[model samples]
Target: MSDIIRRDPRAEWIARNRLHPLHAAMQPAQHSWMGPNGVIRKNVHGVGFIGPNGIKRIDRSGAQQGGATKRTAAVEVQLPLHQVPSPAFYINVVPDMVGGRLSSHDRDLLGLARQLAGSDGAVLAVVFGEHKESAFATAGVDRLLVLEGHEFDGYSPEQRVQGLRAVDQQFNPRHWLLPDSRSGGGELGRRFAASLKERPATRVWQIKGEECIGRAGAGQQDLARPLPRLILAAAECADPISDTRHEVLPVALSTALARSLPRIEDLGAVAVDPAAIPMAEAEFIFSGGNGVKDWALFHQTAAALGATEGASRVAVDDGFMARDRQVGASGTWVTARVYVAVGISGAIQHLQGIGACDKVVAINLDPGCDMIKRADLSVIGESAAILQALIDAVQTYRSGAKRDAA
Candidate 1:
């Protein structure tokens, strides 16, 4: 039409018209083409494309591309039914002036009872004073049997044994769980086990499956009995899982039975130092090691800090401290809020005991020792010199506090 001339304009138009159906048939339904670098490009409907080298990769699904998918069905686990002992008893005899409240040790025994007796099984808690039903119910006990009287005011070994015997005869429980407390539970449990001619595992700390394990001598041991008749559990062994709403059962004691129990002679009690709290229950502990030479200064520092005294195995073996005060794998394990290790060359056994401590402060001659490395704060120095300085600092602080108060 302008400068260009078409020799076959009519023929070209005719050819295009004829080829239209053929081009349509040759083309694919879904569009796909090769990229410039020989990579294949695909449309939205295509799952993947074949590369030039014959490698295939899938495209990201909607779920993987930041879109939420419908949640899958939950899978249910099948739990085996454990057959629990029927009519299990958790006996607790409160001490005089304790207001009939359950101690931590007593609560542990009740917890073991609840664990042994599943949700459906009957777990009865027996007490010898007037107590709130909510207390036992909060500990997951199914029932409470309270025997309240003036005669049951004070704790007596003889009275406890008699009451336990009477209750045993009445209920005839298959299993009896008692607290292995030094106050009175240990004695009661031993005597009861002896009367029944059954050997009980004392101070049990772990109950896995059907086997009960605890510290024995210098190490741990397990007792696997098909059915345990009686168990004296440690306070650290079990924790309470309260879920049951308990029923209160008040058992009235006959005057004859109550009076038949012999009265214990009241002896004046001696006051114990607050710092003499057991290592297991101590909030703060000041421990001495073999390198400590000035024992007097060490003790003075402990007193100033209101800390319980503890010793390493080497110190105990050398007669620097009592064997009972030794803290280690071969000794008593302690759980404290703060533990101060003075002059201790950290051994593996010693570390095991203080493993539960919240904050550990180590003062040793060598900073490369295990205790210093594991400690939250480390002070490298002679033990005796450090102890004296600490004592003096504490005294100055106390004097300043008193002055401020005045």
Candidate 2:
């Protein structure tokens, strides 16, 4: 009996049998407390005994309780859609799109493009080849133009330049925005600008009413100039769009794009150890701190998740991790896409280090910690249990995915 998974039959029966003697005992506890506006009430998360799957399972079908799903639906944020029926002009953006997803740099550029487009113009995104990103609508793209072809795949900058030229000839956008980042965007933007015989703003950080301010003289001075047609913007040039959504309407060129002969041969990605990667360059970071009780388990968890390991200042000082692995203002500042802080209390220095990270997930016992307040997602619980459960979940997902693939 101890080994078998118990069903929530009693809860299920009581939901249907409301007139029974003890129906209320098994019924789901709901939000009956008065809301803010005096007597107003809302039915938010319902309470019941944990089911076999760790959620309340009863006859009620309306309450769906997958852990991830519940968290996302907690606030039910619906950004208002921004649509442009007829655009006066176009502001184009080419994202680095590292790993087939929009980086923080990409989103920031889109936000800048949104500012440039305003209400009259549209923010158009130019994607080379296929991508896995589905959030272009929320990322402030009014029009999405994906130039898909084998010729555009893998280190083919010459081919990509030709594709951009074709877009320019057809759309003749008012502005071209690309990230002045190490991951291909900067070089490509410069190449495209040269093709069009237009001088581009490079390493651009900010834009004023009619002038653009960018770094000059080895980051010693800021160069202000009139806004140019082409811009290679740096990270954090603008905040990403969060208040509204865009149409993301698909667009295509009328004529076939010109093809360029390949000067660079395509080589696939090379494997590197997660430990060998520096925190500054890592995409996913799993960090630990003083609250962690099991160091071995934490290391195992990081490995299972395939994340680069990082540690708080306290953890490094305590000799739990290497000094090189410390993450803070005094340590390495990271711009990881997803930063999971296991037990770190959010120090100001630590927060500053990860300020540029896109998402922060905090797992700790204390819900009121500074880390919890700063985290995009917070899971308040015992670290050991959470880590173990996470490892199991990852294994399950991988196994399921492999089975489906096979």
Candidate 3:
């Protein structure tokens, strides 16, 4: 019989070797001007806001007239380089589709870029097509890079990455910024940083340095060399104060390249797993928000409706709901057959991901809230009352159907 309790000599050696810790004193601690965890410590001199218009949208209305053009291609006519600053901060717009309608996530992306641009950084706002002219105009970004597209050519990730690489190689920015959404923008931004061998940061609420990382190959042998990449995801953080009201900004890429250079082990690209988003199969979904005023009532409402309950990040953050059910840009992006927003103010970041539902019912006391405007059916009332009524209505309908069947 085999010795069941005895371990092999090789197994014992492997386990012991794994447990051996590296010498603490030999490894130098990383130093930063900001706090240990703070990513932004240096003053940003230049920034880049690059938008890759790889896909172009043709005017379907003029399809018969052969007036077809790519949407992403229109970047050329919109943002001329001379209009931009010597080393302007760049902002790129990434387009998205939700629920058969164009989503407003790109607006949020522009908003983030605009906020970054408002600092002492020259802003270069890039657009894919004429669609974003108004968005940039409203955001008040003056300089633009608008690249025109071929009629059939659409947004390509590799192409955008190359365009960004070209600009960064020349300008060398201090801070590179982009949205953290799924539709190619986030991927391209990070890939550009990796291709440039700079630290690629994402979900970044804020940044101030050009330090990035790049990788050549896999495994210990490859890591033995000086790896040149740093990818950051910057979606989670408390709000920070931004002062863009007074100062004229510098170029994003140029300043980043000039400053914020740190000596450290080359941190590889922060890998982001493709979000395995599960589509909501339910016909009706009940979602609550911080505005519910009563967390218990929110749960009661969901239970009463026999509907799955979902909460906004605020509710989840405050311990009202499980983090698993939180819905927003940083949370689960859900698409249900029917979606009901309860006591939720439809913020652009939150609404962009969910607007794809076939039917939307909003229950809120605030008639002025944007959710009311976007909902297919808006019930201007308290969530508790509205939820109770809905539950009752559903129960009654079920009973009637059962009776008819009998």
C-alpha lDDT values of all predictions: 0.66, 0.85, 0.50
Better of 1 and 2 by lDDT: 2
- Model 2 C-alpha lDDT per residue in residues 1-406, reported as the tens digit of each score: 4798878887788666645656645655655543211223323233443321133423233335433332333556465678999999999999998888998889879988988988899999999988999999988899999999999878888999999998998999999999998889999999999999999999998899889999899877889999999999987677567667788999998999866568788888787789999889898999999999999999999999889999999999999999999998899989888999999888878987887788899998877666887899999999999999999999999999999999
* Local accuracy of candidate 1 as per-residue lDDT tens digits, 40-138: 434423445442123343434354476655334464322222232444443332221123566545655666666676544566566776664356545
The deviation in Å at residue 371 for candidate 1 is 23
TM-score of each: 0.45, 0.75, 0.36
TM-score-wise, the better of 1 and 2 is: 2
Model 1 clashing residue pairs (backbone)? none
Candidate 3, poorest ten consecutive residues by summed lDDT: 219-228
For candidate 3, lDDT tens digit of each residue in 265-342? Answer: 334446332122332434356788867887676666666665667777787888887787776667766656578788
Relative to the unseen true structure, what is the C-alpha lDDT of residue 54 in candidate 1, on a scale of 0 to 100?
34
TM-score of 1: 0.45
Q: Ten residues in a row with the worst lDDT in model 1?
A: 90-99
Cα RMSDs, all models: 23.9, 13.8, 23.2
Candidate 1 Cα misplacement greater than 4 A, ranges: 1-99, 130-134, 206-211, 248-258, 261-264, 275-278, 281-406
Candidate 3 lDDT at 82 equals: 16
